[model samples]
Target: MKHCRTRLLTACLGLSALTAPAFAQQACAPRYPPPTTIAAMFDMAAVTADTLDALPDVDVVLAARGGQDLSKYGLRHSHLAFLVRNDQGSWDVVHLLNRCKTDHSDLYREGLVNLVGESSITTDLRVGVPTPAVRGALKALLAGAAPQARALHEPRYSMLAYPGSTEYQNSNQWILEVTAAAMAQSGDGTVLDDRKRTLDWLKQRGYTPSRMHIGIGKRLGARFFADNVAVTDHPASERISGNYSVVTVESVFDFLHRSGALERELSIPHQTPVPAVTGTASPRQASSP
Candidate 1:
């Protein structure tokens, strides 16, 4: 009779378990506060894509150094899809997302090419003198010989060309040639005169000249002076015939100074006059000699 009672109790318990509601099998409730606008959604997606692109490109295994999972650094299909859409829509990528995951070296190379291309297009559109106002100001300083300053306005055509890997020795010669041609028609005696003066200035600044080939035109025939230590010009081109010159930092600054392209200082701190004092100071006695 006790065994029967026990069996009856077990059966009741099993029945209760079987009849209990299956809360875990129920569907999840929807989350609230959905994204408000299409533009906002696009912005969020673009930002995510940019974040993915900014990840460091170093081999994940090497970067992780045997601790973190390298797989985490590898580009995901989802990330690629996001990047494709962002690139299609955005004009300029402002924010880079993940610095750790992006392949930085490749990105740097690609960025250099794009910037050069855009700059070339913009520079080619502007005609006439490079800096007319500066030229006029210099002419005024020299007293009414402004028309003769036309020599300063001579056209110097610049092409973006790619230099061959072995063309490092040819850059300076090309720059000399172009400068010669550009200054030739200026009635500036000889191109070497200006070149010599420019070279002397550069030397005084502690720059040692080296013969280097910079691919800057339709053909990789342009040459310029480059010091390996003091100057670096990275050459990039889609085709050998379309190579561009990445002007050295020193060269650009020197050019701006020589051509008066540098900006003038505004009023100096002490130069501004104080308002004239209207009220008089206490008068001294006339008897005091």
Candidate 2:
């Protein structure tokens, strides 16, 4: 069984879409139109695809996209996805995206080219490859991702969601929790299927998530109006002492690194060019990673 916890809706709070009023939802809708020129679109897609193609021998991979200016809060990559080769022998980038006009997010399967094209910001990307020890389990998790993802998923989205609490989840939090399912070990190396149990294991093992220092006005306004903004899932001690939780791709990378699951890190350069072709298809080989 899943242990879910949630609190009252808050107002707008996003570095990407922050700085808005209580009813900012109407004003804060994010939109990304298609690139103006075909050449511009090809450049973004080719660079993103080439980056993935460069990772030889990597089967299961974690990737992040930084299209926003999150540097003020010490964030580089704002979004994350798992890259795995699909059965068709082509790589795919799989992740959760919040469905616009709704509070829920569902799994999205995108090619490396589309992944780049979907970016609302710049085309820079980051990738993390796990050690061989964790790769097998990651494969299993990917194979069963749909059912498992749906069962534990909550439609509520919060950028500063509490990791330990089941109340809400951000994009990175979902990745972290799914990783927990892969790394959860009993006496031996078996993983825990129950999400609650996996979470318990993570806490016992000292998996620390990033905590953002939010001020009074931004924090209060977000908590009052936006359903996607939350504060109650955080610990009472943190609230009193003022340590708020915000899950980022960096936090998940840190947790995996601390747990010794990460083997290598790669920084993909957007300036690098790929041979531009009329077709948008990425060569099919294995999967998204």
Candidate 3:
């Protein structure tokens, strides 16, 4: 009887922790700060980009990082960016990021490693390679991506944003929409341009965002405390039904491949295992430890 009672109590405690409102996140709100000037995250991002560049004859590739181990919730790779060397021979990684650790909410483009900054829980990453067609479009759009990102970018940042809405955008969500512009195919079998048109096309073609199970407590607290976090973007039905859907790297990759966009993928250590979906995506594409 005592053992059974103890088990029940433990179960209750676990449930409470999971369901508990972000008392911890609010009271002890984990201060997500930027990396120090002397930090190595900056250099690491460059090194990672160079290493991806080393892939035999692969000049540009889509790189992603989870920063935190959300494997228990199925989001191992949470953020993404395009790594390339421009005509000026300088390596540039164009990506979107929430201007968090600040008073206001906005998006900014910084160094490659700055994406992870001091937020990364680990040093590993998972990389995705576009197909020739996708890559061609990706390369062509590089020059215009900055402005495109700026246009699609909403200063309101939310990790649990509605995938279909432009109200609030996250790091990976912006990339997904921008990439959709490059990879979207229309009814007449022609690729589309313009962010609004491509996103509309994505909706028509059954593109779905990944559902996050962050529970109601964190959702409420996040919105209450963080200016960048918004919970209303998700559908009222989904929120009432307890389904927290947010755009993520996994969803982006899944959607891209489902639409015949992503050509290859590479997963690395110190993170969740890669997807088993068929394609050129490998568990490890000859990456070093």
Give each model's whole-structure lDDT.
Answer: 0.25, 0.63, 0.59
Q: How well is each residue in 74-98 modelled by candidate 1, as lDDT tens digits?
A: 3111110001111222212111111
| Order of the predicted models by TM-score, top scorer first | 2, 3, 1
Against the true structure, what is each candidate's TM-score? Answer: 0.18, 0.73, 0.68
lDDT of model number 2: 0.63
Off by more than 4 A, model 2: 1-42, 117-123, 185-187, 240-242, 271-289
Error of 2 at 240 (Å): 4.5
194-288, model 2: which lDDT tens digit per residue?
55766788788788778777777777787776666677888987777667876688878888899888888887655433344575656573455
For all candidates, the clash counts are 28, 29, 1
Summing lDDT over every window of 10 consecutive residues in candidate 3, give the lowest-scoring window.
18-27
Model 3 Cα lDDT, one tens digit per residue, 1-289 = 5334433433333223323321111122334333342133444444454455456656557778766567877666767887655554334556655443332234333344444454333646677887766666666666643454456665666766777776767778777876776664222445544546656877887788877676777767775786766678778888787677777778888887787776778754332223345566456874636
* lDDT of model 3 at position 202: 74
TM-score, candidate number 3: 0.68
